[model samples]
Target: MNQTIHKSQEKNMILERTVSADSPRQDELVPSRYALKVGEIDVMVISDGVLPLPTKMLGHNADSATRAAWFSDMFLPADAFDWALNAVVVRSGGKTILIDAGLGSDPDLHLPRAGQLIKRLESAGIDLASVTDVVLTHMHMDHVGGLLVDGVKDRLRPDLQIHVAAAEVKFWEAPDFTRTDMPQGFPDALRAAATRFTREYRNNLRQFDNEHEVAPGVVVCRTGGHTPGHSVVRLSSGGEALTFAGDAVFTVGFDHPDWHNGFEHDPEEAARVRVRLLRQLAETGEMLVATHMPFPSIGRVGIDGDTFRWVPAFWDY
Candidate 1:
């Protein structure tokens, strides 16, 4: 009986090895794309790739024990967390609007696993030139880097209109806006990129100060916290709605709305905005699309006493 069992196990191991040899490497496999119907509009959630960040950077203000507890509870590794790089493409009103450009084409500066957005879009049959407008959520490198290709800014396509928050432009443009929160050389890099973008687009770049509609079914609202001009986009058609919460919360952020991320310019203000937004989302039952959450980062928030909980949206075909 023992010999028979051992032979069966050996056979199973051989079968597994054969299957593994036939399968493609994980990195070579095409990333999954997700889609949802918002009334008549089609929303595509494409992935740039996943970024591995230190777990300590998240919930920086929380106590060590609390952070550890949360991480352990979520079954996350203690040292690092895999953060998703997601961007939205909204097709409506005869316009193809990309909410945030993914990490730029370079693979060295960003994670090599990331920066596959352009290829992914092409695979989806989305013509690079068909993207009419790029609505920036903020000036973060991870969010706006895709606008540049081979050192040229706003080169994603020709005759494209780029929209950004006026306040965000002001914050990044100020000569003395240097701060410790930004990565080293970030301010200079931003300045250089901004210069190129302005020169390239010129009259085509539009900056707005307050809440305003950018398209027939899209509007931008200032939700300052992560940055002075960090904003969210509201996509609504018919009665369905989804708010693109830009860095408003990372994974497990909904569970601790008061916890501040290390990258936040104003930690206090960020916490306040998060608490307010989480509560509103929980009560209203509106859908949220977060850039840093897991891939296909669409979900809903639910009230959990003073805090909130993240409920990932069900995958629908």
Candidate 2:
């Protein structure tokens, strides 16, 4: 009896260690990447992990009681929660495009749970050198920091084209945080990350004024809300379409399109942009995915009377 008990304890310890975050990527307990097709374009939504942030960030302008009520209705903690971070890989016209690299590493930020993009990509058989283009919806650290990860630059192709809005690049030069309501130290960290990313990848940036096509059926259009140059990517081929909304819409925006996310540089404009996009998606019936939505973020927007509704797409598998 003693021997059997000891052996069981040892086995449990091994299992725990294997499932820990530091374990090999192959040992991950849950699926980290999801694949789907947008007409003829091949798309994959890879989980970059989650960012646990204060609940106040969800709707900084709302009254505390109202915000708490929303959280309660959603069955989420009223104080804080994890915000999903997702990146997409698109293949069309013989070109591979990456949308919004995940947050790399920021030790001082104490967000060690995120920055899993690179390893997850490798596990999914996506080679950095194979990426022909990168579409950045915005210049936020979480969206561009993955490229700044040590050794990532050396692995990427020298000819890789990074498509971003011209205004986004210019805004980062002297970023305005007066309208943002981020937590302490966020502004400084964001500024530093943007500056570093720009300096390091200046040669690869392909700036567009309003809209640009990075690949066949892959169009990125500037939205100018969350940031001075925030944008979203639209994928259309055959008869299907999907939009990868970066930071423009969040989990809460579906229910409260006007709630101001703390990360928005211009909260009011951000709200307007969210409502406009949701309305358009609802009318057209196009599929939607966003950076901060729950993983596999694929869904369709619906009109819920005066508000909006999120109808998650049924998993193909």
Candidate 3:
């Protein structure tokens, strides 16, 4: 983690808030749940909620008609895509690590039926008060908004340790929330949110950097490109391992080494990181986890012909 002093100029905060984040409505509860075991670590996936976005959001080159066709095959709305948001919990070494908190704001897309991250924790009999750390994959609203309860004061647990990336913090600390191609009001919301982040809850924040091991069984790897300073987690106990790849690639077919969504800050660099991580994860042959991937997004990655494909876990709960 970066111990350097933070300079939260208005410029950087705008850039940071405009970046990518999980999209889901908070009203929904009873988040979908899935379990994976990595050695002695117990990993649980609590559903955050699901958002149906424009099908065109799939790929930059994909036009309206193309997106419609893709959605048509699935019998979904011609113009929409339903994406799921998940928060994974790993319990090992007596350290409870919760990766990516769910949606807290966004009333329009909020799933009055899906924001049960906390309830799921309760259902699993896991105590949120005991959770030691909150590791964010990225600071988009869906991922970090849960740090505080909506419209409530002093919501975050006092003892919880929050870790983010130095690079990500830098991006949001800049001024001018608007991106080059974003909509008009996008920049404004982003800018406002960044300042709120600094003023409201700066003390609990720690900028995660490099490959630091947060616990005896958990190690962090710098895997930016999805959002600047985006990081992935590696959990190992006994001899089993799991790599939590948060939004590096959304779908199996979309996991091309050379492919990247237009939203990426640097498309070329993002593509390179995609390939590198794919190769590394494949060689390890351990289970994988994804934030935006379908429910119970934990599984395996394999080489298919020339590209990689997600091999979803085979089991029914």
Candidate 4:
């Protein structure tokens, strides 16, 4: 009996050591999720992955010197900067709404570092089936890519109702959408993805024209510029409000809203929209959640004389 007891204790010790060895480290890059209470609603900010853009592709009108100076001011190298792909999950009105599904399941399409949205969602304890609504800010691949699962079109959360700008849907779905005015393969890719979205979510897709309430406290505001149908989502309750500024204002653009970017479908119009939204948010003192901002992507805009500044949300913990 003494020998048997000794063996059992030894086995238990081994099990404990094994469990300790497998424990996640503090430095590990686990699922990045943040939760905030927007009045009576619960909002979750999650990351799909970070995307690295070549320096030449940034700040369309800004000269190299200006770009370098801006990066230096922030104590960050211009060449090392990346775009954080953020998606939001909102639990309100007895519904689970996901805004901007991330880079999908394949890492090869845009950046190999991305395509972690589904995994991150799972890690965040969010069931894919529980996502009752998907409000896309635009049809950009990065935003809509996660609609797919394992490279199969519309396989990820297919049952969820998708809401998009009516103009955006029509633009991408037009038979003549193969025009070469845009990037070489952009029109084709957009059309293909839009086609799949149309087919798969035909019964579940919802399109809106102007400012319309999508949920009890969520409204889709038309803030065109990045894309014709690109819009921002506004959530409000009891006078407290937050706006998900989907790609309207980028990192540097916060200070230089006039310095248009190369990726904008209409740079001039995009700049106008961005400046207007920035000023409005700053004046209203409301929180702004940007998709391409830093990891948490939750921040606020402050008007600085004629320009604006970004104030990233402080860690509550």
lDDT for each of the candidates?
A: 0.78, 0.93, 0.68, 0.79
lDDT of 2 by residue, 1-317 (tens): 99999999999999898667354554466668899998999999999999989999999999999999999999999999999999999999999999999999973789987999999999899999999999999999999989999999999999999999999999999999998888888999899999999999999999999998888899999999999899999999999999999999999998888899999998999999999999999999999999999999999999977688999998888
Candidate 2 weakest lDDT stretch, 10 residues? 21-30
Q: Write the per-residue lDDT of candidate 4 for residues 1-317, one digit (tens) a residue.
A: 99999999999999989867764345434548899988987899988778777554457577889888888888977675677889999988998999998867543445677767887787678888788888999887778878755553344466667889888887676644321233345556656766776776678778899777778999887777888899999999877889998888788887788876656777888889998999999999899998888878788888888799888888775
Write the residue-wise lDDT of candidate 3 on 1-317 in tens digits.
23332544555776656542332234333336778677878888888777555554455554556555656765767655667788888887788888987765653443464455665666677776778888887766667655545642254467667777888778777753221233234445545655576567678777767667777788877787766778888898888888887767677244435544534565566667777777777788888787778887877778765688778878656
TM-score pick, better of 1 and 2: 2
Top TM-score: which candidate number? 2
Ranked by lDDT from best down, the candidates are: 2, 4, 1, 3
All candidates: CA RMSD in angstroms?
Answer: 5.5, 4.5, 15.5, 5.3
Best by lDDT: 2
| Pairs that collide, model 4 | none
How do the predictions measure up, each by TM-score? 0.84, 0.92, 0.79, 0.85
Task: Indicate the residue-level lDDT of 252 in model 4.
Answer: 80
Clashes per model (N, Cα, C within 3 A)? 0, 0, 23, 0
